[model samples]
Target chain A: AQSVTQLDSQVPVFEEAPVELRCNYSSSVSVYLFWYVQYPNQGLQLLLKYLSGSTLVKGINGFEAEFNKSQTSFHLRKPSVHISDTAEYFCAVSRLDSSYKLIFGSGTRLLVRP
Target chain B: EPEVTQTPSHQVTQMGQEVILRCVPISNHLYFYWYRQILGQKVEFLVSFYNNEISEKSEIFDDQFSVERPDGSNFTLKIRSTKLEDSAMYFCGGRQSSYEQYFGPGTRLTVT
Candidate 1:
């Protein structure tokens, strides 16, 4: 079974500041990594995914994540955050050869303050 | 871009009442799934369906919880008797084989 862990519960940052959300996973087999965002009272939207190839994956809203095999991490990063970037972010993982059911992290709430 | 859509964005029900949450997955996708997230909690998988049959389910999907694909364009989740703990945001998902799953906005259920 693959499991995901998001290290932080909340991250507070000022507008135009850089931000990072850390995520780690454990899986016996190869896995796919993903990031999702949810605004207040809204459904989750896919931010990006790491299927294979390049470890660095870019996503919508100027988000990017690096899949590091050595550290078992897939941390999301944004060079400069905007006030609209405030939302709940989740990290998820699924085995490459298994069912579509994804294991998700607890989530990190990004508070982009002015 | 095509995306999954769910119905009855919010539902309120009494204890022991039946509720059916509906979803319309992206066109041409073959796999479907249901997941739930209680307020301030992580999302949890409930079940997965493929080829008109349930492929897998979690312990949370008890006898009272059932899923069906009544037609080509719809997937439904029915809870026979709901408890207060059943209150949560339910998300429907879909994907083509060997691809990332797309999520619906979700139906929020509040059992009073």
Candidate 2:
């Protein structure tokens, strides 16, 4: 079985500051990686996805994540954050053979201060 | 850009009662799914539907859980004898392929 681990439960940052949310996965087989964000009381919105090809995957809202196979990590990063960026982020993984289902991380709450 | 949509954005029901959550997946999508997230927890997959049947389900989905695509467009999840623990946000998602999935706003089920 595959699983995702988000190292940080909460990350607090100031406006216009850089932020990185760490994510690691354990999967015996090859997998697809994704990052999703959820605003208060809203559904999840996709940030980025790493299916194959380039290790560096850029997403909406100026966010990006790198898929490192050797380290089994896909950490999400943003050069700068705004107060509107305060939301909960999740890291998810699905096996390449069967990508229909997803295993999600515990989630990291990004709190952006003004 | 068509997106998945769900009905009854919030529902309140008594324990031991039955609840059905409804979803309308994007048109022409081949795969459908149901997932739930408890307060302050990760989103957990419950079941996946394809060709009018279930493809995969988690241990969390037991006898109490049932999914059906009653018509051409609607996908519904029925929970029999709901418990307080069943209170959570249920999300509906659809995908044309294995790469990307579009998720609905979700239905907040509250069992008291």
Candidate 3:
């Protein structure tokens, strides 16, 4: 079994400011990590993922996440933000063996102010 | 770029009524899945399908839910009876071989 925790429920940031959304997970087996963004009334869009070989993974829209095994964390970061970046972000994980179903976090709402 | 498409973007049905949500996944993809997000809740996995049969399902996917690949291009999720609690945004997803799954715009089902 696996579970994800997104520490922040809402974040208010000004444009061009750096932002980070924290995520942590617990799993019995090796896992794959992903970040997905959801605009209002839409499905999730893959921002980036960490499968293997890299601790720092870059995703779409100038976003990135660093996977920390010791801490069980994958926190998303963006150096600059645009008004268009305002959306709900989700952190998800799948078991390395099954790799079929995804367990998701509660999500962090990013409100980018112009 | 190829992407998944779903029909009847918004559906409204009465309690105990049946509803079928339709999806057309990426042509070459072999794995399909259904997920739902209730208002402020986290996205929850309902079921996963491969080779015309269900590979896995979560506790949320109950006996009232069924999935079928009726044809080469169409994959459908049928709810035998919908409850008011079933109102949520339902997303259809597809994947070829990579673990990364692509999602469609989603269908909003409102059960009254």
Candidate 4:
């Protein structure tokens, strides 16, 4: 069975500060990784995905994540964040064979303080 | 910017009652999916539909749940009998190809 684990339940950061949300997955075979964001009272929005190619993948809103296959981790990072960046971040994984179903991690709440 | 849209931002229903959630995807999407997130829990996949039929479903999707694209434009998820445990945010998603499943604003279902 495939599963995702988000290290932090909540991350507090000041405005204009850098932030990193850690995620790890357990899977026997290769998988696809994704980052999603959900604002207050909104749906989940795709931030980025790692299917193949370079390990470093850039996503919307100046966010990026690096996929480490050896560690089975895909952590999301942002150099600078604004108050508007406060949201719930979720890391999801899907098996390469069964790509339709996404296994999501317990979301990490990003709290940006002004 | 095409996007998926779900109706009934919130719904409150009595236990054992039937509830239908509707979703409209951006034109030309070939696949549709349903997922749910209980409060303080990770989002869970329920089922996936393709070619007007169910392609895949999780264990969470049982006999009580059914999906249909009745009019070819509206994708609906029907719960035969609602339970208190069914209270959660239900999300509808659509995909044109392999990756990038676009999700809609979830419908918060509250079963009393």
For residues B1-112, what per-residue lDDT tens digits would candidate 1 score against the true structure?
8878999999999999999999999988899999999999999999999999999899999999999998889999999999999999999999997668899999999999
In the order shown, the chain A TM-scores of the predictions are: 0.98, 0.97, 0.97, 0.98
lDDT of 4 by residue, A75-112 (tens): 99999999999999999987877736788999999999
CA RMSD per model (angstroms)? 0.9, 0.9, 0.8, 0.9
Model 4: how far is B111 from its true place, Å? 0.5
Error of 2 at B84 (Å): 1.0
Residue runs of model 4 more than 4 Å from their true location after superposition: none
Looking at model 1, residue B71 earns an lDDT score of 82
lDDT of 3 by residue, A6-101 (tens): 999999999989999999999999999999999987788999999999899999989999999999999999998999999999999988877368
* Superposed Cα deviation of residue B54, candidate 3 (Å): 0.5
Query: Per-residue lDDT for B4-93 in model 2, tens only?
Result: 899999999999999999999989889998999998889999998999889999999999999999988999999999999999999998
- DockQ order of candidates, top first: 1, 4, 3, 2
Docking class of 2: medium
| DockQ for candidate 1 | 0.82
TM-score of chain B of each: 0.98, 0.97, 0.98, 0.98
RMSD of 2: 0.9
The global Cα lDDT (0 to 1) of model 3 is 0.94
lDDT of each: 0.95, 0.93, 0.94, 0.94
